[model samples]
Target: MDTGTHLVIGLGLAGLAYIDPVVAADPMVSTAVLIGTVAGSQAPDADTLLRLKGNAAYIKNHRGLSHSLPALVLWTALISGILWLVFPALPMWHITMWVFIAVAFHVFTDLFNAYGTQALRPISERWVSWNIIHIFDPVIFSSHVLAIFIWSVHLMRPEILFPILYAFLALYYIWRSWTHYRLESGLRPRDPTYEPGDRYTLIPTVHLHQWQIVKRKQDGSFQLGELRNRKINWIDRVSCAVHPAVEASKAHPNIACFLYFSSYACAELKEHAWGYEVRWADVRYRHRKQYPFVAVLLLDKKLNPIDSYVGWVSDSRLEKKLRMGGA
Candidate 1:
């Protein structure tokens, strides 16, 4: 599931029972639920982080800790406890309990995948990344998107179908996972690379119409080795990002945060609401003396992107000209 799908599904599950009650009851509690809906949203992408650092150790260290039930419970309790300690007059229990319930449900939902979550970790250092649906399943994600769109424009109430649809999705994946496992079991001896270890994510490559397994190698390192896709031999050679084109962008804190917050696939550091700061190469304008282009953006706590058009800045040549004038 994608982050947006996690959000939608989390919201759907949280609101399933309490929607009518919360709406009719105290407005504050309703707002709490809304906040909960917004939180616990990002899809389980602990696996993707492995690719980012080009290793499994980084993901393993951080993934289970933050993504686990224990962490979620402790965090929620601490939040509630602090609230209660600070404002003893308020009913912190309701707030804390609601948040816990919502967030716990969120963590629980991640179990359906081939990479199930590290709900019970330390005792088990395994990282879960389930294979129920592709991490970026357009079909599953679109359902959440369509439902969210309907909610955004219209007063959409929680429907039973959401749960049923979600349940079916989880079950279907469970069955498919078994089938994949059976196929994988039969073929592992033939394919010497198929040593099963923890933190494995089995993803279905859609174009090839076959299942592929990405397992953590015994060296405690994760490898994206090909597995069980020989039936449909078309394999993608495209590897993950080797280098990030953000050296210039990294120099500016504002631009860096904008990159984090705005979720712009690529961020530019050159020009903003205030003025021009950094420069980079891009397709729109390839750093000429005359033409100037810049964009501004903001990112939220959840790293969702928001973009704003800002004033342009001088190109490098013009900047040099300005420096000469000042001198």
Candidate 2:
């Protein structure tokens, strides 16, 4: 989920904390729980600080260790401990429990989106993306906003209303998951070449019935399409052939980082007067017929990297940069 969604959800969780007798009994404890909940909700993303190092570092580590099992425990303890010192008289266990819930919820919700978290680290480092929801689902976000509004205006009891809202959201997730499963299962029969073990990446859009699907072929190419009304409309094929230039460019840190972060990466090599330019892209996300999340690397005649960039770039800006020799 996006930062704003996470923050609003955090606020909603704080409101939900009113169900606890200890939290409801004392205003001081309530305030502490509020702070702890909000902070814990945003804590795992503390890896955003790695952006100062570079996009490569940030992309590689953003949801890796920070959202792992160990990090969840650390974030809960750290946030609760800091709040404890501030409010030494409050029930420490209640604050700690809510903070832990907030942190765990943040990680859990992240698993449902395309950019998933490495929440199962040590046990497994695989990026567990359920792809059932978009990064910012208006339905989810607006529901929270509406609930917060109602809570602020004292229109309904927090404990009563929030549990109902969450229950609905839970059902919504299950419906989305069923839709995703049906779409994925249907694709195998439609495509003649689809083998049993081949990988398929489905990214959900804000619209309930729309999804972007990527089917990885055995030959390292991707079949991209959009699923509408349970039917797939083929888009384009992105080649991931093992070109020498593409292979050579992988040695660059930017390319390496892009490969690590992208689940469906495809590389294209172009020759220029100065040198070679290799463009690597994640085919999972396509907008307006463009793959915006990419890494571009320029290499001299000897295939030595001259310059490289790893991040999201607009189609126009990317073409302009490539025209200027990856400037």
- What's the count of clashing pairs in each model shown? 12, 0
Candidate 2 least-lDDT 10 residues: 318-327
TM-score of candidate 2 versus the correct structure, residues matched by position: 0.95
lDDT of 2 by residue, 1-327 (tens): 999999998998998899998998898998999999999999999999999999899988899999999999999999999998899989999999999999999999999999898999979988888999999999999999999999999999988988888998999989989988888878877765567666777789888888888888777888898888767788898886566788899889988988887777898888888888889988887888898889998888788887877888986787565544533
What is candidate 2's CA lDDT for residue 125?
A: 81
lDDT of 2 at 294: 90
- Write down the TM-score of every candidate: 0.49, 0.95
Whole-model Cα lDDT per candidate?
0.47, 0.88
TM-score of model 1 relative to the true fold? 0.49
**Model 1 score (lDDT):** 0.47
RMSD per model, one decimal: 13.5, 1.9
- Those runs of model 2 whose alpha carbons end farther than 4 Å from true positions after fitting are 191-199, 319-323
